[model samples]
Target: MVLRAVAVSRTQEDGGRSELLRGTGVGPVGGLAASGLVLGMQCALLGVGAGTGLLALEGARPADALAYGAAVCGTCALLAAATMLLAQLTTDATGARGAGLAALGLLYAGHGVWAAERWSRAGAWSPFALRGAIDPGGADDWCPLLVAGAALLVLLAVAAAAARGRDLGVGLIRFGLRHRRPLRAGGPVTLALRLSRMQLLAWAVATAAVAGVLTAMGENMVELARRGAVEGGVLGSLLGGSDPGAGLLDYIGVLAGALACAQAVVLVGRFAAEERSELVEAERGTGSGSARLLSAWCLVSLLAAALTLGAAALVSGLVGAALLDTTAGDALRLVAGQWPSAAASAGVTALLGGLWPQARWLAWAPLLGRVA
Candidate 1:
């Protein structure tokens, strides 16, 4: 009887280990390495594409192109590493998912700052020129001071939102309910929604704030142009023929929105995978159905994209109008024009989440392909 019991116990232990492995998608080290390699290749291709395109547009030399490509690849690798580290640390799928979003938000903010710096420097107006027109010596001191102040303000606002979000364990803006009443029983869909909602909102707010700042800055370009600070007529034409600042802001906001939307799609795709794993199934077996579960996931994902983009657009429009002294109508028109492309990008991401179960990372393939 003792020997028979021992054999039965061994069988149960082996079965339990198998189930755990399947649930987490954790396999042997070889399998993990293989999966990582595949992801790296896809990301590298994207980096190459983006690098080459940027080089072509900027008319960079071969050396610059190589440098840019290397940088892109390195950045992608860093992002991947950060993501995996977050997954390991949280040991919770939802936390891993939120880390992906928070990383994207940081990326967007970084890009916005970079762009703003480049635009401000390359922009037509310098303190020297302003000094030449008015008081020469005074211009130098004030110009840098003004730009630095504005940049600092924007950065601080974004940082504050991020900090607040971390505290609340939600997105920058609160969404849905702050707290849920303890229920006698809840299912998978409810649980998924609860886990994801806060993270989604935090990401949206961070992305939107960056977009808004960039857009507002762009609206000031027309004033710069009117002052004849910008010599290049061609450049002015490209910048929307409005105030140089406003034009640049508009362009940056649109680009930022597109990028943020891509991040949102990638995020949602990952969420879907987490949902399919045994963790969600266990919750579902308790009460959840496919429709309810999927719907909640979809809603949270869509909300993240919409709120991020919408905040960006609205902020850009408001700031641009304020700076340019334009009517609300004009501002709305500019914002509206950029929406179609952004919406399409978001839709493509949603489709990928729903359609592809295995190789779900392929949803990012298109964005990666564009980089190549």
Candidate 2:
């Protein structure tokens, strides 16, 4: 949302690409710092709330809960800041989001490995070791907090230094194929797809990576289930079915569907942004009407959601078959079974885009409400 807001602001200014680069102080450096701080603080508060609430329910001492909350908040602060820096350093919105999400996944995975191995000597070095420090029934320790705080300072310094050398709109890494053919005329749908193709690809890759990881760990997950580790829990209720082998596959499908729905909402919001910025308007002035352009954007947003989600489903199916002893056909069928829910979420977003383009963000309310 922050990145989208930034992108929208950038589009509001009347300037060439190079001019925006020259506005780096306000555009990249300042925005990065401010957004990072805000997101970091929010994450910290959220972690604190969740951690304290759960600990309180478990009859832990208030002092201990507060201490754990502090540790979680500190770790979250560093993570949020680091992710924001990574996002700012990326060239496009999609890359920014993807990199940040991947970094988050890596941090958690690293912490999981560090904990599961029962290795304490290297705990301080893991990016998310703070989580382990706040373990229930453990000694109250501040070492992880100290380490995270110090690391955050160093990371902030490095991120600021890195920002100094980068052009405002360019990323550290850039790759694209030059067009060899003459441009052809197209409707707003074509234009919207072109603009969003990179983001869609990034979303697909992230989804596939997550699904692949889950699929590869299917055996362990099944074993855990069989041992009654997750039996009758939320996981068991959501993923468990007649065939234990298919439980993990079903879980993946549901998760992928939710992600696809969120992506659809984001895509629609992007369409609204472009329309409000007059990018779509300019195209409409060229032998098109507002209604026609809007219809095109709606179609394009739907298509983008479908294509990206389809890619995720396909990859998940193939990966599950290869790594989890599941048939590719079954995996595909599982993903297919969940498509209508995603389509419903996208439909709500599209309705908002058509009726209240400037207020399409309200479309998020449904998803949040559903989750709550």
Candidate 3:
């Protein structure tokens, strides 16, 4: 849902048309609301359809499936409204999207905690309360829909008001233009990193927050360890074999590795976006050389992937050391052990993106299997 909203927002804000709109928009607030409506409607339909179809396939009753779909649709529209507000808060679409991604990760962690700690019976005001929006197994209780619907309305209202007050093509909170000294990037690699600073910051913060949430659930993980699903593997051993509270760490570590690889795949695609936007062609015309420009992103993608896992390992390791009664080294090892996988995924994506750009999505095949 976050991705869908981000994609739609970016499409609506394509660089050139935005400048034109700035001069000509008759009613910025109405236009903003209209665009947000379009985003919400599209996301709502996709969410409902996908949720219903998936639930039906699981043999859920028609009433239950519809209920789940409605919950999903409400959440999707809420996220779209959120993205609209975020887009105004941050100066760039990518930053807004990155912030949205961060929020999504935090919510996912919250959902995990909600389930692990069994907070459903708690009062509506309990912080861990989650509705059927994320945890379908808890769908029998639908009281959360009112909260979600209220949030959606509030977000849309705030977004429209903010739109009315700000000039088009700029954020509500503008960064200072003054600088003490000239800022310069040494090379294409440095430039690429500079441009992606916001995204990297978002990923790091979100990963740490998630790790903290997992650490806080350490006591519950002891009960989870009884399942023994995380036992008996070379990698599993590094995660503390059969230790109390270790099974959940090991399992989530494995999933986090797949996420790291997914990040690599996304980073490699940045070059493709640049190419499609003619940025690469223009840079080549400036004598930057096509090879140098593309190669910069290739190296950046590999480094970014490594940086992600490194950050995850560091945070999760701290969580283990502080709360889980386990050695930090073991937890760090489990989380960071997937560097090779991330590097390989980067190579595959960069290769396919450079060669058969039209079929670059094929690069995602390995990660798909890993995730499944």
lDDT of each: 0.50, 0.64, 0.68
TM match of model 2 to true structure: 0.78
- Clash pairs detected, candidate 3: none
Model 1 lDDT per residue over 141-160, tens place: 33433443354344334433
Give candidates' CA RMSD values in order.
13.4, 4.5, 4.8
Query: What order do you get sorting by lDDT, best first?
Result: 3, 2, 1
Per-residue lDDT tens digits for candidate 3, residues 1-372, read: 565565555435544455556568547676676677777678678667866686756666666665666666776676677777777777656677677777767666766666667664432332224333435544455667677777778888898787778765567887764653564777778878887876876776677677667766665445444455445554345434556555556665766677677667767777777775676776677568756877787787777767777787787777777767667677777777777888888889888876788897787799878876
lDDT over C-alpha atoms for residue 330 of model 2: 71
Tell me how far the alpha carbon of residue 7 in candidate 3 is from the true structure, in angstroms, after superposition: 2.0
- Candidate 2 per-residue C-alpha lDDT over 186-279 given as tens digits, one digit per residue, 9 for 90 to 100: 7667776776677777766767666665666566666676666766777788556666557777877777776677777776666565654467
> Once superposed on the true structure, which residue ranges of model 2 sit more than 4 Å away at CA?
1-31, 102-129, 172-185, 227-240, 322-325, 369-372
